[model samples]
Target: MSKIFEVPLYPYQRCADQDQATPVRHKVVVVGAGPVGLALAIDLAMQDVPVVVIDENDKVSWGSRAICFAKRPLEILDRLGCGDPMVDKGVVWNLGKVYFDERQVFGFNLLPEEGHKRPAFINLQQYYMEQYLVDRVRQLQAEGKPIELRGGNKVVEVTQDDERAELTISTPDGPYRVQADFAIACDGAASPIRTMMGLDFVGRVFEDNFLIADVVMEAKFPTERWFWFDPPFNRGQSALLHKQPDNVWRIDFQLGWDIDRAEELKPENIDRRLKAMLGDDISYELEWSSIYTFQCRRMDKFHQGRVIFAGDAAHQVSPFGARGANSGLQDTDNLAWKLKLVIDGKAPVTLLDSYDAERVHGADENILNSSRSTDFITPKSEISRIFRDAVLDLSERYEATRPMVNSGRLSVPCTYDGSPLNGDDCALMPARTRPGSPMVDAPVPGGWLLDRTGFGFQLMTIDENAPEALDVDGIEVKRLALTTPGDADGYLKQRYLGDANSAVYLVRPDQHVAARWDHYDEAAVKAALLKAIGR
Candidate 1:
């Protein structure tokens, strides 16, 4: 017999003893062991940066909080050495259908392209995501990567100056003070660091409420997103249905603001609601349920002097788009490389400032899309509802109107259109693989292009016979030639090049395109490298 796959909750050990004499200074201290903080720690550890993560809880998230993991985040997880397990254990989904009352309106496919390594989205419980990240961190620690996690340790106070930041952590045993050259506040939406620094998270708080429930049932349901406006059983309200692993299902029913929360959560009331949605004959067991009202908000800046913020601490959007955790993981992806370069003294401290600029831009984009989805689900006025119904009715026949029915514009990686670090573009180059966009995947020898591009700067070129002896500090060069094993399909040439033969692309450590050129220039490459690293 084999032991079942159960998420382990490690016990909290006393770390306050180490701070008794002289404070042990660390290179980077991460507060909060949530998905964002853990992923960031893993990324920095892979880059050989010492990291200590402190969290107030010893267990994974209590419920199935964030279930949808998008492709961009899965790619980031792949770079962190844990993507395969997630994909193996998750329920992959790409297509979603929208319905108005009882009629099907329109549908969309998230990843319509081929030859990609990962799927459009994977619905794994948030607990499983955290468990996998913690396991990866432990594996890296066994190999001496200098990653430390202290659960049940909460930060009581945070103070920072230009040189360093100090955190006062309280545990069951006692309290201790730890100092670090730089600290990241991943402590969640009600962040102590954000409050201590007097930063305001400015955005709109939606008036509508939603009831989310997780159920265990042995039923055959299509593994696709199904959303309905004014569903038949749950009259005059919207409902959503999705499938997850472990014979579990997630359902969300829209509830207006004026309902009594205490009465709605009663077992009898919840049973009646579940029976209506799942039907009278379907047998199911309730796993967990919760009520929530979301807000679309973020701190104006992610970094404040020596203390940086990521995840729910820096920004949060409505749960409709699945952007909450996906965007947060992207935050760590953008920050880890820059922070490592800054710590290694290879780049100026100003490089960290770009993390602030780029991630804040990403946060704003998520908030905008979340707001639009909320408005469509719960129309503000009678006129707005009339317009929304008209569009849904038209979407059934016309392909053009399908774009207007917003059942949460699913999460996609945001392109940094006007980023300060973007370099000049070549007119002849393909637009999809241009500067400031995430690198498009193409077939490569043995695997994919992204497999070779890890957590470091890479210079990619399609020129077969490029020079082999060019030396640049901290930057790896990969050449995709026609003679390579996987280039037989010509995907590298067709997707990256239209009619041109070859081009040089300066790719950042985060796998985003920094710059591209028709021909390589030593002087131009060095300048773009410097600009990319924030010289």
Candidate 2:
């Protein structure tokens, strides 16, 4: 995994900017070509926005770093034109079993419903996800979309003004400069751009470290997440097991706060831990091993002047919920459309503030959940540990106590309950599909509902037909009309229409329900549309 992924996926090439006497200007310049940055660039390019992505290294991530991608992120990737390949090359799972001291406590089904297009989660190597994104970037470039991936082009320095941001890039030849109307930092947790900007990133830090080992072996474990709290193997501490592609399994062993960082990562020590968990009969080769410590934290403001942050750069959560990359993808989904509308002058510049408002709400939600999960997983005191174990015990025998258990509180899509962009809502409508919620996927007449709802502001009518289109103050909104006859599965009605026989919904470009009504009305739609775009 290391050697193959280390090979440059986007090797450096000299650009015209290097020869130019002055810095060349671009619409958007993205830093750090990780999954988040690449996804953002692909999104902007798909919208015909010129975006250049620069990274210090021209390679994918070395290890299977963020393997559990939830359904919401997969949906976001679908919109970016690369979801199919990711699912095709990944391991899918929905059911997860929790264990307490070798006893099966409880199990969960993340997506028990039938109509969703994506699975509850997919376990693909982070490198593979990044490769798919890079491939998408190349395909867009070949299609003549305004996107560029410049590997080995390091952003050495960045300075922003009210109008634009100027970045100095260090390339193989020398240093060159590029000016951008918007600069987005997608660098990892230790964001260099954040440091350079001198922004304060505040939150709780964890001293405890976990040993991650990706091993290859043929095993018969079910395609399910298995989490153990004080199993006989790794007795006092906790352990986790997940299956990835290529017969690879990810194992995590909680190493307490005080430990020798170097000695624990040694091959012999890692092998010993693996043997203790999985008996010696199962022969496995350690593919990759590393020690990681995570904390719950985020930037005070995702958008600071002309510069913005997304993904790990903007917020970081203890990986238990798989929120880091997943939330980052949502950040791009939320921001890209607003940027497009603002840049085209269709929406006021103030619309960008909603990005901060909405995503900050999202970040805070993730941080809160993540903090609770961390405390539950790694108890701070002996009394806390006793209470946790007792809860696990009760959960195994009684269904009522199962909800009290928190095995990393796996990631779920964020719903902006009080977003400023949110408009009208109907008390009769299903609360799940209310304003500021991601549209629940359902099977339609042609294909999936999400697939039918393309990337743009759309008016969705269920159990009733809407006009072919609506022009709300020069904003073009297409329509997707589905009927009761087409709702053969009843999911469309159950998920969206609720008790209402007919409904009309105004969907934002990101597929979030902006405003929904019992029936379509021009005046109401116009006001909601204008409010949604910060007019």
Candidate 3:
């Protein structure tokens, strides 16, 4: 086996320095500077780790791509020092309205006041998000950080051994070879690195194609999300209306599998659909439009030796639940901390394997959830449509079943149950909040309450009676006084727990709970930390 650490760059050399004749080598080389790749670069650079991110595109694409941003992703961007600007420019939506035909069936307030904090969702275009990331990368570069963004450069080949991975790239100047301790592929669904390595991207592709159009309209629509079932334009079709930042609306229409992609993408067809959906009296201009076939697939493995995969390279989900980009960001969040530990020599090589295990788990869960949501929204057969319509119709009478009928659970954060990072005895309990869990609002002492700060790891210990007994290095621990009526009762009820003030919750960097203990014990805290960091 090859050694784990190696110095690929020379002592007197600089990386991709425009004036240097010698090729540049970095500590890590990330292929594809999309959102996921850019995020990974920013996080690593903030930790003083050297990274080179290469993208084939000359600039960010301002297409009608991803527009919905979840709360978790917003928090991740905030930690990278870009979230405030993003939130400032983007719109925050808490309610989503679901419609059947022309009537509204149910409306849900996503950010219901559980204990504290706003809803877990936001709306922002992919292009704007990328622009913000690019600005941050440039700022870091100006500050002499060891992170580089090489535009108009494509990775042609990747060869990895045990210690390092070498990338051969085709740039404007000529072909060049760059070596790094690790290579991360964030190169979308058609990842060249993943194909070159012969990894399996396993899942089924849907038959229906979707037409997404971004337009600036004159009419005022409600800020809430609107999903129309069985819209009139195309019978048995579904349409989605979402408000963008500047009076722009994102509309998606489900086109049957038989339609020709090239002909249907013409300006006439797009304009016709828009007119039918938003009346001819409304004045609007088309900004961007595209037709794409959705897929529900994930790479069998996220890692192969020194080369790893993130974002669409590892998984692809239907756009119904907006899981594709959100899950990609989650992948970066999980891998960033682990890579930091390994680069700082604070952990072993075996710790890196957990990235594959943990991220793959998230990717699979995202795929499953997205696929299920897509099936419900766009039923394939007549029988499925009939059953779905029946449920929507029946939901009108059954007031108690409205929540389940309009299941928005897809937007919920994913959890890791079977990973070696979780507690061994966590399965024995029936509590709703457990180790390796996603963070949710809960009550605490002094009526102050306890909620995730949307930053790094948070350790909440309810044992205010004995706060001195539990302490851990490199981890932030908060002691909450478990007193008062709302303190213990509200916390337990919010987390759906019958009992109160019995445990400590350890949350990960991504706002997911890592481990929980019923009693304040040092051994349990240490084990939870070790399992959480994959020690």
Candidate 4:
């Protein structure tokens, strides 16, 4: 098939003929060139691993979906060396205001503390994010790295055995086959890979449809997030206004399930509502608009043989808390390192199973949290609505409940508690922070802290009984004392030890604590490390 679009061909495609006989293969094959897929490709390539990324789209879509970027994802991008560019271009927001009957019921700050390495969230269009990742991937490919981007190529079939995955991709020319050590499906929620594998995507699909519009407005609006419940212009409807780059704003209107999808999205209908909501004096130009039905679903399993699922393919949550893309990117961040470990022979193949287990748990939790927020925002029954309204009224009198009223639940970092990689004792304790179970940030000597830094096995020990040095080849051991007496014990009190004592904590690259011992035994620590890393 001849090229029908004006999009430029990826550099890898330019020399297709010369390498036709070589039979393209890579350490990993990533399907779909969305933000998550591209990010994973670049990250693995940065680690000196070969990656080949394929996408059906010739160019990035112009639609403005997924405009919110969360803190965890930004941290992942920072590891890839692209976080600063994104943070520079996007608007950082911390405060969110919730309204009931046009009255401000409560307000909360997203970034509770400012001096941290990353912010709470950023506002940027999905298209721009994809472009940024694509650009970086291309740059890495140009440097003679093992990163390749193939556009207008779609995966038609996948066959995976215990060792490697074979993919039959349909390119513009015709169908071709490629082999890789592993396959990652970053395709969207309606992933054909997941369906082809006969995996069950079980969850609820809400009846209400949401209308999203990105408009260029001249009116002055606060940089903070604004939400309206039961507004005068649209009764029984909730509207959200979020600031975006270039004076553009993202607006969402809850159109009940009964309305016709086509009619509700018409320019006339949207213009009428905007006029009523903002008054006649406000002027704005519509940039893009679309209507969508939200769903909360997760695949029965994140892996089938050597083929793995990441991002939306593994799970999908409602956009209420902006968990959709955030969760997907986090999946990539978790899976990339594990795959590298297995390919490099640093760990056993069993380590890959932990990726599926840990990420699936994260996806399930995100679905539950986002679903609960959606239920509170759009109650189905009259009784539920009354209860919600009463709660909002009660919150006005009680200052302690204001945070809950503003946002149902804060987007907390996730943890892998019951995984086989985690020790029995490690799974029994709770986190110090609300979502603190994932990784502990405790004080150490010389103003340097011990945390999960890269994709590999890690062990942090402060016990004097622990071995003075580590003998493991691929493991990193840090021995440091907490500078502040109360700080270290306060951080790990609930999670590891009930009392302040010298202890050793084994952590995975994904930031999950694997094992902890109050008094370190060299043999026991070695066994835990081998087990956690699947050596």
Q: Best-fitting candidate, measured by TM-score?
A: 2
Question: TM-scores for all candidates?
Answer: 0.96, 0.98, 0.87, 0.88
Residues 150-253, model 2: lDDT tens digits: 98898889998888999999988999999998999999888999999998678998878899999999999999999999988887889999999999999999
State residue 275's C-alpha deviation in candidate 1, in Å: 0.9
Q: Model 3, residue 415: displacement in angstroms?
A: 1.0
> What's model 1's overall lDDT?
0.86
Candidate 4 residue lDDT tens string, 1-535: 0121235535236336234754466689899888889888988998788888888876765667888888778877776767877899899988888887778887778877423556788998887787788778877878887887887787888887777888888766777788888889988878988777777688999888888988888768878888877878779878888998988889888888888878888899999988888888888989889988878888887877788888888888778788888887788877887888788887778888888888888888988887887788888899988887888877767887665553435465677667667662432334442111455444333331423354555565543345444756665654433322544445434434545455666656655566776666777777777777766
- Model 1 CA deviation exceeding 4 Å by range: 1-8, 16-19, 473-486
Specify the highest-lDDT model's number. 2
lDDT tens digits, residue span 235-351, model 3: 678888888887778988889789988888898999999889888799898888888887899888887878989998888988878888888888888888778777777567677
Candidate 3 TM-score, C-alpha based = 0.87
Say which prediction, candidate 2 or candidate 3, comes out ahead on TM-score: 2
Q: Show model 2 residue runs off by greater than 4 Å.
A: 1-3
Stronger candidate by TM-score (1 vs 3) = 1
CA shift of 461, model 4, Å:
4.8
C-alpha RMSD of each candidate structure in angstroms = 2.2, 1.0, 6.6, 4.2
lDDT of 2 at 450: 90
TM-score of 2: 0.98
Better candidate number, 1 or 2, judged by lDDT: 2
